[model samples]
Target: MVAQRVAVRPEEIRRHNLSRLLRSIHQHGELTRAELTATMGLNRSTIGALVSDLVALGLVTEYVPSGRDRAGRPSHVVAPRADGPYVLAVDLAVERIVTAAVGLGGTVHERRVTTIEGADRLPRAVVDQLAADAEWLAERLPGSQGPVGVGVSIPGTVRRRDGFVDHAPNLNWRAVPFGELLADRMPRRLDVQVGNDADLGAVAEHQRGAAVGCEHLIYLNGSVGVGGGIIADGGQLHGVGGYAGEIGHMTVNPDGPPCHCGSTGCIETYIGEHALLRAAGVTDQHGPQAIAAVFEAAAAGEQRAVDGVHTVAIWLGRSLANLVNCFNPQVIVVGGSLAEVVRLDRVSVETELDRRAMAAARAGVKVLLPGLDQDSALIGAAELAFGTLLASPDSMVASLTTT
Candidate 1:
């Protein structure tokens, strides 16, 4: 005999429907009540109730269209509330930290960037500085209510279970409980989520940047070092333990110069900022401005700069060839300093790809620059914070009420 079905609770159904409606509006920016009804395939009355609940919770706002002449009565548009809850997004790079306050509908309300110097390189010092920065940003928000949460993007591998930095060679951090450290330093109790910068970059690109609508994509980020993130079948590919996208460490030339990770001939050794600078016989520090100067020189026909970029392109192409054969992504986004180099010398990189990559693997694959550029990881961090609220609208409302 078949088992009896358990009765579904009406409250649970209401919560689920509310979440679905909010998610649709969050994803699509703004939708009229009638449009939401048509898109959600729900009855008009149900859509009205759900939107009303969302507005009551301060998650969305309904406004009549302005400056438009319509043939019939105008339907109200539902959009994320401008004065609603927001989250703090921190992007902790090797040499700098960027903090942003992001609200619903992907609006970045406030942002600050600070460069790290000598003693601040210590992990503890970095955490303290970022904590202070976050506190400052939190105070500037419109309301007194605390942020929904904090989402941090680090340039390293992070453990999924406990938010530890498994390895961050560029930052010289290893096996540090970075998430816990930051949480402890927070001015107030808040939920903190940590993720790899490259992984988050891929998330941003797939959702709102260059890779939008592309299910199979790869994102390669080059700063002081190289990092990678993969998206497969419309989801971020986090392998067991969340350490899958370490493409920078992939051995490209076993006999080449040693990498910061103690690996020889890694992809970063060939395409990273230091590698490019050394190849061009430049001794300036490896920063975004320095890298841009190199590219500008190449654009002006400087022989050393041109040669350095070409060498980088060849190695990068070889690395992309491997990724193409492995993942067969529809698009490959080259972000950060590498994007500048590629923008200046696309032909060299494409020629190498044509020669090295398998025809089947290279077919229909487009290599593009990041649409969001340096902001991709930061935007993704904001998305992470927004996702936490969207996942549990009822709990979020309760939390806000108590605050």
Candidate 2:
């Protein structure tokens, strides 16, 4: 076995400490110098030095508390700088594209959403639209440098090594060099990262949404197509080739309807937006809004819509049963177009899970609606971009300054 390499450089050690400090502040929103010293278990002088370095790098700012106790002088609070380095986050959904410029500490500085016309479904068209939207959003940030990184979230499998979208059945894209295409369109040369939307949704939910603090969780997304992400033991489960969370393709009914992935009876065949609308006997020219209307009809006691929701919920619960048995996740969050449907009739889904899943596993799990709503995947993309900078603040700072 090859020996594990260890980092021993003083700069490397300082960078590591800075990363830890940034993560701590980012996770907690803000921290006082005393709080940072206590939480990080570092000496006060070291904590001060780290905070000073972050302040100098323009990553954080030190401010005094608004109200103070009558005891003594209040410690200065360290918070992420509002005008600091930011990342461009894009969510390229089948029906729409949402883009945002997000700052450190999970703050969304600016955002824009554009619906995709049916004619603009090609891979090149999508990439061009995304590049245009990113440019528009970047232009709105006043007195700021360009984004340090860009993260694109797509509804498909992505190769881990280079951000290539291996396949996006919903978008009719196959083995597309999405990162390269988007990078070419960008005005500036910056690292571009791509990830599966569901996987990124899981990361967002685990870090800042409904599944916060959950060591084991499942994030199920419903869009034009269905997808899922799994977090086991506080880590994402990326199987060989980073396609582990393709829960949409799991066989729920071997004899059911066909899927775009060339598989029959997959969970997506029953619960995806198009499938749900078809089952409800509803027809509309628009996409996600049409699905939302169907769920609204179901809530208002429309027979066709109610039946459609019931059928989808039953199938979704059955699929969740399998996932629960496999991962024993602490929570299962349903998001995207299916969120309202799941929220309207949660009992029916739970009853089905109670029947199909193991009693022990079913008892401990909590099924929830998305905390971040439609923004989960976009925020996850931002998290990915922020992660790159936080991991190596010094280098990231240097790159930003030079660029």
Candidate 2, run of 10 with poorest lDDT: 283-292
Give the TM-scores of the predictions, in the order they appear: 0.95, 0.95
Q: lDDT of each model, Cα atoms only?
A: 0.86, 0.87
Task: Show where candidate 1 strays beyond 4 Å.
Answer: 1-6
Residue 249 lDDT in candidate 1? 93
Task: List residue ranges in candidate 2 displaced over 4 A.
Answer: 1-9, 68-70, 283-286
Against the true structure, what is every candidate's RMSD? Answer: 1.7, 2.1
Q: Give the TM-score of candidate 1.
A: 0.95
TM-score of 2: 0.95
Error of 1 at 330 (Å): 0.9
Best by lDDT: 2
Q: Write the per-residue lDDT of candidate 2 for residues 174-222, one digit (tens) a residue.
A: 8898888888887565778888999999999988899999999999998
